[model samples]
Target: MSHLVRSGAWVAGALVAGVSLAACAADSAPRPIDESSPAPDASEVDYRDGEYAATGWYGSLPSHQDVALTIEDDIVTEVTITTPAEDPTSLQHQQAFADALPGEIVGQQIDVIALDRLAGASGCSEGFMNALAEIKTRARA
Candidate 1:
């Protein structure tokens, strides 16, 4: 009937408008930290020495990542990142990230390490940051 068609069109229009608003909001969201800039020193912050681990989720496909950090005298001594990526491409990307992470973070003070992206692993970086925040909380003396 004419009424049914009119209601359907109204519903479709509402759906389109909702999707458009969501897209705009996503576009205006804050961007990740820039890797090129120098990170501020965290040497002054006191940290309890121990191994800390945290899990984080990232990407549209929602990959889960775990990061473990070993701290000694408030400095990071070792770093381990694990990503259980079933897809071959995802595995490769995660492996590259893992390979590059140690050199980027090891021997640095925990507070100064700002890891957002490395070795083309942007999505995993978000999860890494989240895990790092947890580690920081545990590290507080």
Candidate 2:
């Protein structure tokens, strides 16, 4: 009876080993690459492609700038900032920031766009970034 049980156990072990070998052979077989799925770079971006606009206000005096941006392929293709500067000094700073804006952001990825002390306008940079956050929200995919 003991011999019979031992032989049965050996047979079960043999069956398990056979199954494992079959599985290993299946794993080693070449599988065709799935080309149906889009490549990571070609996949849809989280932010939708389109023109977006937002108004951001900053400073103790609370100046405002209207930010408009065009996004294609998750990158900023164009940008415009309309500063309703109430004073000449503020207008000069805003204009400086606006002039520097296109070069800095036009070719940048939208998700990573931010500025600090651009064109010597620290306050304008702050307002621009604040507006960009809103633009990102509007452009969310």
Candidate 3:
């Protein structure tokens, strides 16, 4: 019926308008970085932490990255990242990779990082893995 058709059109238009308005009101601000955070002290780091290393290779990716993690008494004490190949325009991806792991992993021990369930920036999960691997290697040495 004509009445039903008109009601449907009106409902669709309202939904579209509401969605656009919501998108416009979203916060587009960049996340803040704390440069003042203290560096990991060797004295505080447990050199005898368990050695763990892993590499994440995705597809035919030409580049390589490395991550190292040191765990002492079931706690993560150190993490470092090395990049041999990096995409030029991927700064946000790089930072996300750096910030996601260390702060949380510092006092925890785990066999693997939960990459799939990461809140956002899955693209940098590979980089995070590299850093974890590097920590493992360095700790062993």
**Model 3 segments beyond 4 Å from truth?**
1-54, 117-119, 126-141
Stretches of candidate 2 exceeding 4 Å from the true structure: 1-45
Candidate 3 per-residue lDDT over residues 40-135, each given as its tens digit: 554454345554444343324433334455566646665543333455534444445555556656565544344542336454564455444444
Give me the overall lDDT of model 3: 0.43
Q: If scored against the real structure, what TM-score would every candidate get?
A: 0.68, 0.67, 0.44
1-141 per-residue lDDT for model 1 (tens digits):
011111011121110111111122357768798889857556657899977767666676767566777789988887766657888888887777878887888888787788778999887676677778777876799
Best by lDDT: 2
TM-score of candidate 3 versus the correct structure, residues matched by position: 0.44
Q: Could you tell me how far off, in angstroms, the CA of residue 28 lies in candidate 1 after the best superposition?
A: 11
lDDT of each: 0.67, 0.68, 0.43
- RMSD each, Å: 17.6, 29.7, 21.3
lDDT of 1 at 28: 72
- How far residue 114's Cα lies from its native spot in candidate 2, in Å, is 2.1
List the lowest-lDDT window of 10 residues for candidate 1. Answer: 13-22
